[model samples]
Target: MTRRILLFGATGYTGGLVARALLERGEVPVLVGRDRAALDRRAAEIRPSDPPYTMVLDVHDVGTLRRTISADDVIVTTVGPFHSHGRTVAEAAAEAGASYIDSAGEPPFIRWTFEKLGTRAANRGARILPGFGNEYVTGQLAGAWALERAAEMGVPHRLEIGYFSTGGSLCSLSRGTIASLAGSSLERSYTYRNGIRAERPGARSSSFRIGGRKYSGFSIGTTEHLTLPEVSPSLQELDVYLGWFGKASPLLATASLAGPLIRRLPGAKRVVSTVGARLGGFGKDGPESHERDRSGVLVSARVFSKSKHKLSEITLAGPNGYELTASLMAWAATVESHASTRSVHRRTGVLGAIQAYGLGVVRDTCLHLDVREVESAVVSA
Candidate 1:
C-alpha cells in the first residue's frame, strides 16, 4: 500500500499554514474539509506550481469519513476546539485503520482520547495521538530527553516542565485556541503528583529565570501529566505549566478557586464565550511572519533523581508555536506513513509523542530548535 498524507481542516489558520508548509517542503497532500470553495482556493494557492487533490466532505458524515481514510494513510487535523468536533474524526480514522494526529491542545480532549479511545484504537490497531501541537509536544519531548540524560547519572523520578509563551505585544493566537479556552474555561485539570493523579485547588504558577531573563508563568491544562507518567516509568510527579492566555491567565486561578460558582453565575459563560470569540475571531489571521518570527516557546526543565539529587537542567527553545506545531505534526505524518509495524510497539497503547515516535527521532527532527542540557550542581539549601 502506498503511504498517503491527508490533511483535514485545510482552510483554517493552523491547517492552512500546515498545508502551505507541506507544499513548501515539496509535498503534495490530499486536503479535506467542509468548504469546497475554500478548499479549492487553498489547494490552488498551495499548489500553484502543481495541480492538487482535495475532498469536500462534512466531518459529521462518519461513514464517508471512514471510507475516505485508508490503512496506509495518516491524517493531521486542526479543526478544533477538539473536545466537541474532534471525536467523530478520531472515530472515523480509527475505524478506517488510519493513524491519526491532531493540533488539539485541550486537556479534556486529550484525556478523552487516552482514557476513552486509546484502548479502542489499540483494538483496531490504529494509532491515534493528540496534543502533538505546540501546547504539550515541546514539553513532552523536553521531559523525555531530560529523563534520558538524567538516567545516565541516576534514575529520575520527577519531571518539571515550564511553558511560558512570550512576545512583546505582537503575540497572536488562533481563534480555535481561544475557542478551546472558552469551551472548557471552568474545567479542572489533573497533574501527576507524588506518583498519583491529583488536582490541586488552583492553577499552579511560578517564576523562572532562563538565559538571564525572568518570566512569569502559570499552569495550563494539558494531557502531559496523564500521558507522561506512562512513558516515564520512574516518574513520581509531573507538572506542565503554560501561559497562553496572555493577560487573561489569572482567570485560570480564579476559576480554579470558584469555578463551580462562577460557571453557575449569570452571563459568566456568555462573557467568556464573547471574549474568546473576539480574541480568536474578527478577521484575525494567525500569527504573521513578523509575529511568528517574534513568537517563541521557552521551555525549561529540572529533572530529579529518586535519590533527591538534581540530575539535569534542560531548555528547549523554539520558533513560532503554530508554525512549529504544523511542522511537528507534518513531520509525524511523514514518519508514521512509512513506519513499519516492527518499528512501532503496539503495547504502549496509542502512545505519547515520544513513545509513538522514538525520543531520538523527535529530537533529530527538531534539530532546528535548540535543546541544551547541562548537569546540575547540587546547591545546599
Candidate 2:
C-alpha cells in the first residue's frame, strides 16, 4: 500500500494551516473531516498540483475512523478539547497501528495518552505522539537540550521549564484551545517529583529572567513531566510553567489553591467550563495573520545539580504559538511518512517530542522554523 498522510479536522483553523504548510512542502495530504464543503473550500484555497483527496467521516464514529486509517498512514489531528473529542480518534490510530500526532495540551488527556494508550500502541507497533504542537514541544526540546548539557557537569536533579509569549492578546488563541483550557481548569494536574505526582494547577509559581526582564509563570502539568526524566535519570523533580497570564499569574495561583474545594462543589466543573468558554471567545476564528505575526514565544529550560545549584540553561525563541504548532505538525508528519527516518528511530507508543525525533533532529527543525536557541549557559561550581 502506498503510504499517505491524513489531515483530520482539516477544516479547522490549525488544520488548515497544517494543510497549507504540507502543500508548500510539495506533499499532498488527504483532508479528512466531517464537513465536505469545508474540506473542499480548504483544498481549493491551497490548490495543490494534485487534486487533494478528501475523506468525509465523523471522527466520533469509531468503526469508520478505524477503517479509514491504515498501518501505512500518518494521521495528524487538530480536533480537540481533547479530553472530550480526542480519545476516539486516538484509539483508532493506536488500534490501527498508524502513526498519530495531535495538538493536545490538556494535562489529563496527555496523561491518558501515555499511561493508558502507551502500552496498547506499543503492542501494535503504533507511534502515538501527543502535544506535537507549541503547547509542549517547544518546552520539550528546550528541556532535552538542557539535560544534555547538564549531564556533562554532573547528575542533574531538577528540571524547570517556563513558557512565555509576547505581543499577543488572548484573542490569539483558537476556540479549541480556549475550550480545552476551560475544560481542564478544574482538573488535577501532575508533575514529576521522584515520580509522577498529583498537583493542583497553579499551585506553584516560578519566575525566570530572560533578556534582563523578569517573567513569572504558574506551574502546570506538561509532557515534560513525563518525558524529560527519561533524558536524565538523576532528575528528581520537574516543573513546567506558563507565563501567559503575566501579572494575573499570582491571582490565578491563589485561586488554584482552592481547586480541591471548588472542584467538589456541585456542578462546579460544568459551571467553570461554560464561563471560561464564553469569556475566552470560544466562537471566534482566533487572531489574523498579522496578529499572529506580531507574536513570539520564548521557552527556557534550566537543569540543576543534586546540591540544588543550577548547572545549565537553554532558551529558545520562536514564532507565534499557532503558526509554530502548524509548522511543527507538518514537519513531524512529513518525517514520519518517510520509512527511512522511521526506521532509524523505530520508536513506538506514546512519545515525547524528543523521543519521537531525537534531540538533534528536533533542534535542527526548530532552527529551520526560526525557533533558534537564543541562549545557552553552563555554570561552574
Q: Report, for every candidate in turn, its global Cα lDDT versus the true structure.
A: 0.72, 0.86
Tens digits of lDDT, candidate 2, 1-381: 336999998988889899988887778899999888988888887784556889998878988988888789899999877887899999999998899999998899999999999999998889999999887999999999999999899889999999888777677777767777877878989989999998888878989888777778999898999888888888999999988766777788887878788889999988877776676644676778988989888899999987899999988888999899999998888877875424645989999989987899999999999998874342100
Tell me the lDDT of candidate 1: 0.72
lDDT of 1 by residue, 1-381 (tens): 437888989988899888876776666789989888898898888778665798887778888887778767788888887866798888877776678989887676777777777777777778887878767788887887778788788878887887766572423776777777776665555677755354532467765566665555566556667666766688887777665544555556565666666778887866776677677734475667787777677677778877779897677777778888888787777767677643455543556887777778777877754433422232110
Root-mean-square deviation (CA) per prediction: 3.9, 3.2
Cα displacement (angstroms), candidate 1, residue 337, comes to: 2.1
Model 1 — which ten-residue stretch has the worst lDDT?
A: 372-381
Pairs clashing in candidate 1? 175-280
Model 2 earns a TM-score of 0.94
What value of lDDT does candidate 2 attain over all alpha carbons?
0.86
Candidate achieving the largest lDDT: 2
lDDT of 1 at 264: 80
Give lDDT: candidate 1, residue 66.
Answer: 76
